[model samples]
Target chain A: MRRRRLVAGLLLGLLLGSSQAFACASCGSGGDDPLILYPNEVDKIYVGVARATAFKNVDADGRFSTSGGPTVKDTLTLAYGHGFSPRAFVTGTLPWLRNSRQEATQTSLGDPSLAARYALVMASMAEPLIPQVQMLVGYKQSMTHSIHDSADLKTELDVFGTGFSEAKLGVDIWFGQLDWLAGAAFNLIKPLPHTYDGLRYEPGLASRSTLTAGYVFSTACKTTFGANLLARGSLRGDGVVQADSEQLNHSAFLTQDWLISPVESWRLSLSRQAAFGANKNTARSDGVSLAYLRSW
Target chain B: MQYLLRLSLCVFLCQACSTHSKADAPAVMPASTEGVASKNGTFFLKMDWTTGPKSAATSAATLSFYDANHHQAISVDSVAVVPWMTTMGHGTAMKDQKIVPVAGQVGHFTIDGIYLIMGGPWDIRVTATVNGSVDTATVAVTAP
Candidate 1:
């Protein structure tokens, strides 16, 4: 048993130490910022730095184009939340992202998102293993036109935000009786009003949906170690640069979480993802992120 | 040890499901005043201005091409745009007109910096080669 534990630890450790960037057009290097998406639970706070390396751009051909080199991104996030009642809670994050696309780099405050969640349906005595379902409703605003955003940006990787405002809704499920959880989410985003150099434009997305699953690991110190999978993308939307309605890149992400026990609030996570299967927008990428959290 | 095995199984199964997404055939973009026109029964062309067709002063337009069966042509080696006034008999004279692909948006190329020099009945000659197939088409732009 101890031998099996050592081998598994080594494999997951090896995975946590590397990177990839699977991206789409709207949020590739710049505007399509897939930077920070995690928040601690109610009444807790988390602050961390995250870095992403992106390269091998997917061209319109649906193939990886060699024209541009890898871009790297660093993000800082402050996460907070509160429980108003037994059934209601709110969680949010404000972030800043620095994007580097080859030789050019730009730093800007990223679009912030706020989510209000409610325990919609509780697990019943008849089916305790089914778990309770919670619903989350949220909004995200694009910060691309902020003062820190550069008008002369070179590539999508340099965009700190998508320049679009989005409405998000989703469900969260916790399998308290079991060892795993599953759920889904949806978002509708629209380009915020933007005008530059006497030109006006609006960003748009048909919609985006994400499906998620996570498994829990039990440790002697009460430490938590596990892996999470999230598959997400914009289903239909026009990039800020295009007049035609287009599909953004679709991506699947796998994240590993490790929390130190006795101090369970102290946590670290590593993630990797790939983007593919797009029209108008061609993207093939692999990316990894590492982050630490402080929770109360 | 049991937890480790479970974690390994989860990773193995999830990795198998994370393949790059694929979509259907090329979708038709919104039309410009100059709509889609078929050339030689096997290819189709659409003229659109990134700044809207009315922004003739900007001359930032996208020319999109697809096959007869509606498969979008992508990753072409080169795209050349020749701006000629059918009546005036001269190119834009602006030698730096750029015909480049619109990044991420497949089958679309942008034509920028085409100063018409004069607002007249102009023919924009577009020639593109994708996977050894050369496609050329001409469209008329009424300069603003």
Candidate 2:
């Protein structure tokens, strides 16, 4: 097993260091965020930072309402992963968030999440047409301060967490051949209702799905385009529907992945959300994310 | 050596985008004469801002309540105004809004101390006690 890992790492190093003439056999399975890792590369660590600005609100009728000044949010995440076996891995992630508006600014630590994934069908070059499938179960523990005023608009914007523990179930599928790769992932997040500030806030179920397609342009460069869809049910305040709490929004993103060295890579992503449709009680936002990863 | 150089380059790129956030100037818009209906169809509240929309300050406006016909003025027991930024999910720092009934002009009230903390889309949420029942209506306004 150790010999196999050494050979794989050496080959990946050569592929990334050499010119584009060499075939990129290791590039297809590795670049898409350590959602899936092969047997050879077991341990992974990453630091990711993202900035988003909410420019306008999409009313319930899908109309664009630019009523308020923009709100900016920044997030920094640190994650670690280890493969327990060839078909299984576990990951833990922690994030810090800051929200800024014209009137006030807030900074706090976000929820910490732990996920366990097991592959049903491991990816292989021999059957590139058949996608590799994996099922993931994750849990996020709320680590935010108590919400002082649930009815306050600033409190709502400043509070990053749901103030409740959340569970996530998802499936990920990937298909790759040569220099082209594609993947799809869907997740359902359920946040347990919790009483905060003298009110029971039952957050509605939310689902997030993504579709991605990428092409390897060269040994060091790869670009991916993806579309993300997020749908959330209305939040209930003491079993009553909170006004304008439901949301359905979509965003398109472009990402550039650079394999900088044998053991390190960087991904930069730009995204625009809720551009055309009428989203329910949601704001339109543009975001950028930069991630640095190291694996061995 | 090569890996260190690449890591340094990535760090530099990330730093280039990070900047200290400064307070943004408020972008004021024209006075709003928009109307919003109560939650239970009790009445429609029409708003006319006497002072132009400005952020980090207070403005005055007159809120007139009209019945279903939109022609007849309707009187209420009490009125309260909350200046809220919907996108930000917060209201102004000023906790109190002063509302005075226009004498002999039923359903017409002048509201003062409507503070807008910042620029953006704001909802002037008016909650009134009519016939011993509380009803609320939201008027959308843009503050500069």
Q: Which prediction has the highest lDDT against the true structure?
A: 2
> What is the Cα-based TM-score of model 1?
0.51
Give per-residue lDDT, candidate 2, residue B4.
100
**Predicted complexes: DockQ each:** 0.01, 0.04
lDDT per residue, candidate 2, B34-128, as tens digits?
57789988877888999866665668889888774444567689888877654434457555468898876678899887767555567888898
Query: Candidate 1 at A178: error in angstroms?
Result: 0.8
Candidate 1 on B1-144: residue-level lDDT in tens? 999999999998777655322232444544332444435544567777666332224457777776545445545566777775433122444455677777766677778776554333457777777667777777876553
Instruction: Please report, in order, the local distance difference test score of every candidate based on alpha carbons.
Output: 0.49, 0.69
**Model 2 lDDT at residue B133:** 78
lDDT of 1 by residue, A65-115 (tens): 332222687888776667676466666778888877657677778778877
> At residue A179, what lDDT does model 2 achieve?
72
In the range A21-118, model 2's lDDT, one tens digit per residue, is: 21121122222233334555589887889898867656665666543432788988888889888788888888889877766777878888888878
The second chain of candidate 2 has a TM-score of 0.72
Residue A8 C-alpha lDDT in model 2? 95
